[model samples]
Target chain A: MMSGSGDPAGLDATTLNCHELGLSFGGHKVLNGFSVTFAGAGITAVVGPNGAGKTTLFNVITGFIQPDSGECFLGDKQLTGRRPHSIARLGIGRTFQDVRFIARLSVIDNLLLASNAVSGPTGIGLRAFLSEKRIREEHSDRCAEVLETIGLTQKAGDTASTLSFGQQKLLSIGCCLMNPRKYYLLDEPFAGVHPELVVTITETLKKMSKSSEVIFIEHDFEIIEKIAERVVAIHQGHLIVDGPPDQVFDTDSVLEAFVG
Target chain B: MEYVLHILMLIVIYSVLAYSLDFIVGHGGLVSLAQAGFFGIGAYAAALLSLKFGLSLPTVFLASICLTALMSLFVSVPSFYLQDDYFVVVTFCFQMIVFSIFNNWLEVTRGALGIPGIPLPVLFGWEISSKSEFIVLGLLILAFSALCIWGLTRGAFGRILHGLREDEVYTESLGWNVRAVKIIAFAVSAVLAGLAGSLYGFYVAYIDPTYFTVMESILILSIVIVGGAGSFAGPVIGASVLVLMPEALRFIGFTPSLAGNMRELVYGLLLVLILLFRPQGIAGKYDFTQSKGAR
Candidate 1:
């Protein structure tokens, strides 16, 4: 592999920003005046109790959910009101709270599904056969790197259905890891994962943070305190805490949001 | 020899149709009942453009492919936003509408009178007049269709179809235009269906509304289900088994009309048995009864 200091795709320079994002699910007010900005090549943890709109914020930023009133941006590009795929193409990588993948697909095939090397909706019909070999070759290096990162190199050929839950979770995360995006929006990346794999995933996120922005919705405070340089806490669809990890943890409102 | 050649040519032609539908159903995890419509459209295009306008085979195929692909967007774009079963209903309607056109558009289609004497054009200086010659042409088209579909399913485009087949939203989050991919799947399948339709008309030297109905679409889908879907060998095997099995009834000493009725009964039973015992078809890796992404 050619040596590089950061993201091979050079996605580290951009920041993710959302302003006054408002949304409601049947007047439930999932997000109300929610706003946040994340810059630089470092990991930021977004923590909240259930229904606090942490995941909803990620969805809005990623364009999976449209906010009632707001705007989002990636560096300089407008993201709000755009399609999920277009927002993703704007350099935002997102994962779901409930992991989704084809159970029958091989681990490698699942990862390759998200690979940038593959062209989509090629209209040339019968002529697409000619470029198949070249596309396969171009995608090989990234696949190897992702397989190694998720520690599934040996199980690359195995069907994902056969994997354990933790392994499956890692496989889902590995989908986002397949392509290079400026910001990775992971929803509960550590939930239900084995401690051992969590440690491995932590190292991977850390390594990734040096080259790309890692913004994840996490619940566990121990890992958050250890790894997150910054933390944003939301409760009842409003931001309650935003600061260094230690400061946010010490805030009484942060405890009130969780305890109440 | 001519009769056997005729049966063999029909298999090759319908194999292209089977492969086309499999690309949408098995690969994209979509259910479309409009293959017969596109097929009929292709046949009509070929019959009308050739007998009326005297177009060449290449031009006829190209025009049919383009026209069918365009018409497919009418169903694909709107129906894809709905659920799977709703999409099927849309295709069913599309099939009905096409059948209606073939039956009632007397000025253009000659309605129920049908179009006959569809000429098989000369290709590369070869005048294809005999059933054996027609088989050669059908095999060439089948081979090309197989290669293109095989390449599509094995490549990244296939990966998109497979992934979206599993999880449309998840696939979208990966930055792929999942809707576009689904539409493309329909268009490409329709393209091949149109090609097969054109060839079928030419080979039979006849066309009518009765030839393309909702039942014909079901038959094509049955072929995919019986032969297996989602595998390169599945549709080809399916087409061979489904086509050849019905003809086997002809030698059972029953009268022609009795044998014809017997063939339909057997086709229905075979599908039921396949669904009950071997849901994946003889060569298919996918179970059609299972909901998308379940496997």
Candidate 2:
């Protein structure tokens, strides 16, 4: 958490509190009594092995899946069972584990689609259609910055499908950053990313965490240790360890889950 | 010369139809079979408004647009909830329903008797009765409609549609009201189709239930498939091929009676070849088989 514990931006404490979230698919339990309170603004790394419910927790919190029994709150707003778009509008921007931005659009267009003007109250309709030139100018600078941060400035006009897997992964993150949100849930943000650009993405995410709460699901602990202030590790649909990265890594259960 | 102009006029009208259908199919990512239904609604609305009310051409166009757009809501609202094949089914059902209404509503529509004596379009006291004048009027209408469609779909709005087509969840996560955008896309698409229909009614001055069946819907879709769907020029090119190429058979040593049968034969054969070679379309960026057809 590069922002520290100060909350110095004079921001109110908006937390994503998932209480007693239990989800079962068929006879298997994906998240059993998965509850956690993400308070304050900072970067938190959600670490877990495959099928340990890390992504499922994000899916539940983001309204893609309804928990059999649970309630999720983003500050005073209830997020559980709401439409994904409504939750996003409520300021929870997220990236999928497998990137899903529009491949047909130009690389820059993907970010532009997420611009504030595109997300305004009038929506992607007549008003925006009528004032597209002005709307495009309103956020071209920000789109440029995100593209530059993701190191894809030169490839702005190329179709997204032309990009390599890693660049597309970075574009996915770039798309998320284009729209300002209070909370960002990135599932494996650095997956398929080049080593050097991973640092670049980390810096960007770290910078964003200064004002917004950034939670990521990553398996690489070295990168997690570098960026994450708090690490919440889950195993077998339960929270095994949750504390500072050093302590959570030292926990025997966390080690056992990853190793076994 | 006049015959060529006639073919060109038909091409322009079909081009308009393809362009609007492209919005829903190419950008919106929903294959709708209800475009001809909306087209029929516009044609019927225009015929009745002009024949009965004595309204001017512009007013008739406006009324047709409103009526057709309203009718599109019946398809779009449900389409927002349906996915992929189910959505296509809904549009297919909507097409059948529109045809039924046109066929069974005998008193108002005159059943199979058809509406005749649709007046020539008049704008600012210029009667567009000649083939040349009708072609000019069609061009102007096409220009206006294409300009509006271009404006509405050039920037973020178009990208949002592409996003919605690609992945609704990803589009929703970007904070767009996917449902609302999709519904509006349908309205815009139908309005343009309605405009085409109005031009169609005034051009022919005669229309019947048979002209607006599910088969007609399939023809419009074939134009899109042969021409291409996603690109701006794809549908226009598609319309030209599907309209003019078949007609060319009449001039190329084929008797008038033989040309009619040959036209249908060539139309079907041409469509098959185009799809086999170019499933994405002649110039379309989207590969329908990969994204749409295979599903």
Candidate 3:
């Protein structure tokens, strides 16, 4: 494995910035005038209490939910109100908090599906049919590499539903790894994970953060402290703290929000 | 010899219908009940064009595919928003609408009295009026269709279809246009069914509203489920067994009246047994319900 400090300079260094993002669900405000800028490299943790709009933030950023009034940008590229797949094609890889996957597909097949650049809607014409074997082999090689990185090489042929919950979570992250996106949005990658697998996943993410920007929403402070160099915390639909891990965790308002 | 050729020809036509249904039901996880509507559209279009307009076989075939694909949009558009049960209901309604049009539109469809004396195509100045000669043409089309379906399902498009079947939302997040996938798959299936319909019209030299019904759609669905919905051999195997079983019953000393009812009974019994013993189908990879009890 390569070192995690290789200047983090493979993808485009386009920072994901949100400006005055506001949203409400039937009069209950989820995110009110939320704004933050995420670095194009390194691990940035988004932490928040329940109903603090952390999930909503990721949804809006990923184009799953259109904010009431605000805009998101990757450098100068406008992202607001775009479809999820459009945003994904625009270089954003995201994993769901619930660890959703194509359960019927094989473990390696899931990874193969992730690489949209290489695996999207190939033609069924004469030439395409002739080159299918080569295409499949190339994708299989990439999937094998991803399976090895995720420590799931043994289960490559198994259906995804047969994998345990934590393994499914790793497989989900492995799917994201197959794509070379500018930003990675992982929602609660650590939640409900076994400690040993957590260590494996954490190391995998750390390695990935070196080449691409990794933005993850997490609850475990220990995990956030271990991987997150910068922390952006939200409280009740607002950005209450944004700084280094030590400073953000030590803030009185963050402590109050957690306790009171 | 002619009787056997006739049975085999019907098997080939139904195989096309079964596999077409598999594309939507098995790959896309959509249970469309309007397949017979598309099938009816193809047969009527082919029959009318060949008889009234004197169009060649190629023209009628292309027209049939185009017409059925256009009609398939009625089902595919709703699938974008409706959930499972509701989607089935919508297809059922569409099937009824098409059936009513076939039965009532006396000007074009001739209502219950389907178009007769539908002529077979003459190729290379040779009239393919014999059953054996028609079987050759049928097998060639079947082989071409099977090859195309194989090429399609083995590629990236097929993988995306599998993803749509499992989890559509996750597929969208992977940079796939889920709506477009569903619509394309539905159209492909409709076109295939339409091709089969045109072939059936030409083969029998007749067309009728009674041949295309919701029950026909369910029969094709059973072929997919019994033979293995997602598996390549499933539709072919299912279609062969289903088409031959009724013919076999007649040879076993049962009268034609009893044999007809017996065939339906056997189909129901076989389906129940398959669901109980092998819910994943004969060669299927997916468990449709995915329940613990099924495993």
Query: Which candidate gets the maximum DockQ versus the true structure?
Result: 2
Model 2 chain A: which ten-residue window has the lowest total lDDT? Answer: A2-11
Q: DockQ for each of the predicted structures, in order?
A: 0.42, 0.44, 0.34
For candidate 1 chain B, the 10 contiguous residues with the lowest summed lDDT are B74-83
User: For residues B1-295, could you state the per-residue lDDT of candidate 2 as single tens digits?
Assistant: 9888988999999989988898888877889899899899989988888999999998998898788878888988997688989989999999998888888898888878889999988988998899989888989878877786777678667777878888888888888888888878899989989899889999999999898998788889888888887777888898998788767786698988998788778878877887788887887877777763211
Q: For model 2, state the Cα shift of residue B237 in Å.
A: 2.1
Q: What does candidate 1's lDDT look like per residue over B105-197, in tens digits?
A: 999999999998888777766877888888888888899889879878887788778877788888888888777777788888999999999
Q: Which pairs of residues clash in candidate 3, taking residues 3 or more apart in a chain or in different chains?
A: none
RMSD of 1: 4.5
Off by over 4 Å in 3: A1-13, A117-131, B251-258, B291-295
Write one digit per residue (lDDT tens) for candidate 3, span A1-260.
11111222342347677888899999999989888877688888988898899989999998989999878887667789778887887789899988888887788778877764323442122222334466568778778878888999999999888998899999999988888888899999888989999999999899889888888998889888988888888997889988888999999999888888
Clashes of 3: 0
Each candidate: what lDDT? 0.83, 0.83, 0.83
DockQ of 1: 0.42
**TM-score of candidate 3 chain B vs. the reference:** 0.96
Judging by TM-score against the true structure, name the best candidate.
1
Q: Write the per-residue lDDT of candidate 3 for residues B165-239, one digit (tens) a residue.
A: 877778888878777777788899999999888888888888889999898888888888888888888888989
